[model samples]
Target: MPARTQLSALRTFRPSKRLKVSAVALTAAGATTALALAGTATQSTSALPAIDVAKVTAGSQAGTKVEGLTQGVADKAYPAYVGKPTAAAAKNTSRDLTKAPAKAKPAAAAEHKAKPAANRSTVRKPVAVSAPKYADNLDGWIRESLAIMKAKGIPGSYSGLHRNIIRESSGNPNAVNDWDINAINGIPSKGLLQVIQPTFDTYHVAGTANHLTDPVANITAAANYAAHRYGSIDNVNSAY
Candidate 1:
């Protein structure tokens, strides 16, 4: 390998203009070119395009004779040098907001005020729950899905919907490849249980792109997919 990088080597290179002198100035630059060819050299005003300059540099920097050498740069090893590193990328400004936001919430305040034994109420909201559709494990799937739905801004409850994802991916975070009936073109399904690439792309939310592999994006996309296919995940436990 010849110093490969993510970008092409030629595109990054820029030849120094140290030799931009006229033919007359070059002759005056003189003895620097002496002890070699005696041929007179003339200058042309037309500047070669970058690609042309690169090609010429690619040739000459190899120590090939401009007049008749056939050696290409690839024939020899060229010692590589690296410039000093530029300033480090500014420190990421990401903040841990979970704690302060929780403390500031009205629900937290209400909970604190109602903690006294006399103020506690025996009445509880009727929480509707359902069984998992997929038959196996059910732990963590609903809570994760609820968090996903909120992150996506999708308004719905995991109430009767947990069964849907339980059926789709069984809570495997990076699941792909569906050997069952879902495998297409031989690659397994992927992310937050399983979602085929095309379907994910079709249902992906605006801010959540690359849903096929990104967990959050996939979760959001899966929620949207379920909502789009069935009236809700509660109806058809399709993709999840």
Candidate 2:
């Protein structure tokens, strides 16, 4: 047989085998192209040609005829060629999901809780104070009486009260005038200032003990009487 005649005979009988071989070769080429494109996925897609996965997959499956595959068919066949995510992108997403949120400091939270409110009102308890102490003598009594007299608005001096007290009772708080005219009538004059019970009761200052012989009470009442009768005890030098 001639070589040309033998080749024609092979072409007629083994057409299906040739078609299958060509389809397989085309599928492998397309896959290689896809892999090369995937290696440079991070680069500009504007410069790269769009792949036709539909035609490749159709050629592989039919082995009889190959045609342009639709977008839907291409998506099902080669997902990597249609916006497939990279490993770095997937890793970044996983890192973001696993990251922990920032927490508030314990010390700052405690300090905020411990702080006092600005609008809160506070109350204070009253303190008790005792009266001032004085010595147990004539001078002490006079000084104490002067303080009381000043508070009561009665006018008298220390020298005037002291002088009258000495002249009347010789500084004796328990002095009495039993032989006087007032004593004859049963109302005897008594105390440091020789004040009778009626006179003492009439001019007795409040807050003092209501006893004629009580030095402070006696002085205060007598001074008060002297202030009324002669303007002040300082104005009276002798018996009036």
Candidate 3:
């Protein structure tokens, strides 16, 4: 073969290095584009909705913790999935419980507490105090004797008692007449209103001392005798 014909045949059989590299690069680029398109189609089918970057950044800056962002995102996108008035209902229940004490306080206080200040004046007061029935003195003795006498229908006076007591024993309650005719007869006249023991015993008034020498007992016995024999002690002017 001629030299030029041989050279052309070699060129046809083997390509240049630069052309080979260029061809391989073009094939690689085409394959990369096809793979990118396939990835884009997959992303479009299952991609999450876009987040508000500004809000996320602001929340991050304000140090707010993010939780359940996917669910929160859905709730924010659809208004019908929002919460109900449960918080408001709970608040109303709390308010009703707080007012329950106020409603119940009046009834409980009316049953157990003291009377109100407005009604205090209408309450009945206690009865007035009266004097005691018994006293331990001479005046007390006379008053008690008079009370008993009045009960038994025995008539006498304070002046008459004073006169008789003075005349009989000069107001000496313990005086006794041992030398008198009654004493000689074995019965002594004794006490302020002097009378023999027998006479005192015979005319002894109830609710008085049994001892004849007792002043009140003696007076009471003598008065009782006078009441029966002479109608009253006031009628006894002298020794009976």
Candidate 4:
């Protein structure tokens, strides 16, 4: 070959080989850099000193200085590390321990005293009343009927009741007029005041026995009828 041609061929082939050498060199450099970094990390890990927990605790308790630990850091780590109280703080504590509490103000005490108690009236217990007692006789029946009539606003008296009862049935509670006009109508006049069944039932007062032969019931009913028809039993002189 000629010299120029050989020189050109050598230049093109040398550039390809140079490119490969550069790539291989770059790969080796990167591998070496990675190995160096790993070795440096391992050395750094081995070189670090192990922490002695017991020594740190002893140093903190004894108030001795721990290596690389500031006083603030020591206080945060060990809460038992308390600084001495200042002179003013000690004096204030002593005063608090020895001093007596303040008394209530005189004006407040006076105002409390001036306030009056509530005006509560005492409630009295109710007095129980006993009912009136009566004898089991004609006088008793008439008297009892008068009391019931007075309460019911029926106008009659003991005298009027006695007079009518004597004329009608002669004071007999079980007296019956079976031959009278009322009896002929299928209704007999019965009891102390000789009241018929219909009249007795119609004018019957409450709180009295509902029987035709009952002395008090008979008197009260007859008196009630008389009062309605003749203004009062006292005004009726004959059968009504």
Candidate 5:
């Protein structure tokens, strides 16, 4: 062969050093991305929707990880597959009341929550009508109220039984009745219960101060009325 032909046949080719660095850099980046995706896949799936682990492991063994490489992309790829609410739900939120949610009626619900209600039947005034009241002394009217409870056949639940006595006269003999309920006859209702003339006339004896003004007698009459109507002196709660 001629010298020029021989020299042309022998060619020297050397790849640039950067090509080796580029391959190493690319391999490192791919490895890092793989590590990150692996970590994300293993993260606490406690709140996540259920995924079949056996199928994932089978796919991984079958080189499915390389096939699913791009699927691990965070916001765009993973979330696109998930179906979440496009907009927030504010219809039932408290900041806006227009939703008119089904709930307990406001007035009734508030009343129930407030604890102490205006069940006046059970409300007792803190102070005795005037003061200086001794439980043992309990006054003639209180005694009569008890007697009336006995006559009526009511149970003597002290809290309930005394509730009426407290209402009528606060367990005081000096307590007067000046209530507005009229008796229709000449005598205005007076004394502990404001008993009228007709009621007093029916129950009162001629001589004893059992007239409408007498506290003990009036209380006793009221007790009798309660006993006759409700059938128990202790049935004080029913008096109201």
Candidate 6:
């Protein structure tokens, strides 16, 4: 061949088998590098310690337990967070409600029993009072006159007879009203009760003395005359 044709052939000449061998070697090198890196990562992860989840939960057997926590911390914190009352306090309140009430006296009875005596405004005397007394001589004459007047169905008291005798005779047994109206009519009054002759004879008690100056006889006759004129000698306070 000429020199120029030989140079062209050399430029176009390819080593096909050697090229295939180099490509195959490069693929094998890359595959070997990837496998080495994967083995190194797996061995490093397996060398660390393992964790047991069951043993951590088994420490708390009574109440619920959180992960990585003990029972002591949960027991102390449960009461502070939950403020509801317990069963024992509710039972004590129920016992107190079941007890009986105490007995007591009424307010009106206490007030009535404790009232003071000074508060009573209408108190009164418990016994009756008696009339006044007179002298012995005058008392005897008046009492005797009252007895005779009573027998004749006439009404008179010792107090009434004594009062009239004091006004008429001034307690004199032989008193005479000679200057008064009875004397002006020619009939005068005499004795303790001061009876005139006509009045003495007209109203004389049957069993008594028959003189105007006799004390008991004069008193009885005068009371009888007074009873005939007025209602009774007790009703007469002035001269008849």
CA lDDT of each candidate?
0.52, 0.76, 0.69, 0.77, 0.51, 0.70
Q: Per-prediction TM-score, please?
A: 0.34, 0.54, 0.46, 0.50, 0.31, 0.42
- Tens-place lDDT digits, model 3, residues 4-104: 65446434443346545654566666855533443344345334444565544444445453342544454445323333236778688676564444355
The runs of at least 3 residues in candidate 5 whose Cα sits more than 4 Å from the true structure, single-residue gaps closed, are 1-140, 144-161, 169-187, 205-208, 236-240
- Give lDDT tens digits, candidate 6, residues 97-165: 766786555887688788965656777677876634434587777876777787789888888888899
Candidate ranking (lDDT, best to worst):
4, 2, 6, 3, 1, 5
Q: How displaced is residue 179 in candidate 3, in Å? A: 4.5
Candidate 5 local Cα displacement, residue 182, angstroms: 1.2
136-165, model 4: which lDDT tens digit per residue?
A: 999888888889988999998778888988
Candidate 4 residue spans exceeding 4 A from truth:
1-125
Highest lDDT: give the candidate number. 4
Against the true structure, candidate 4 has what lDDT?
0.77
Off by over 4 Å in 1: 1-155, 238-240
Query: How many collisions per candidate?
Result: 4, 0, 0, 0, 10, 0
Candidate 2 error regions (>4 Å) = 1-121
Best candidate according to TM-score: 2
Flag the better candidate by lDDT, 2 or 5: 2
Candidate 6 lDDT (Cα, 0 to 1): 0.70
What local lDDT score does residue 11 receive in model 2, on the 0 to 100 scale? 47
Candidate 3 TM-score over all chains jointly: 0.46
Which wins on TM-score, candidate 1 or candidate 5?
1
Q: What is the Cα-based lDDT of residue 185 in candidate 2?
A: 95
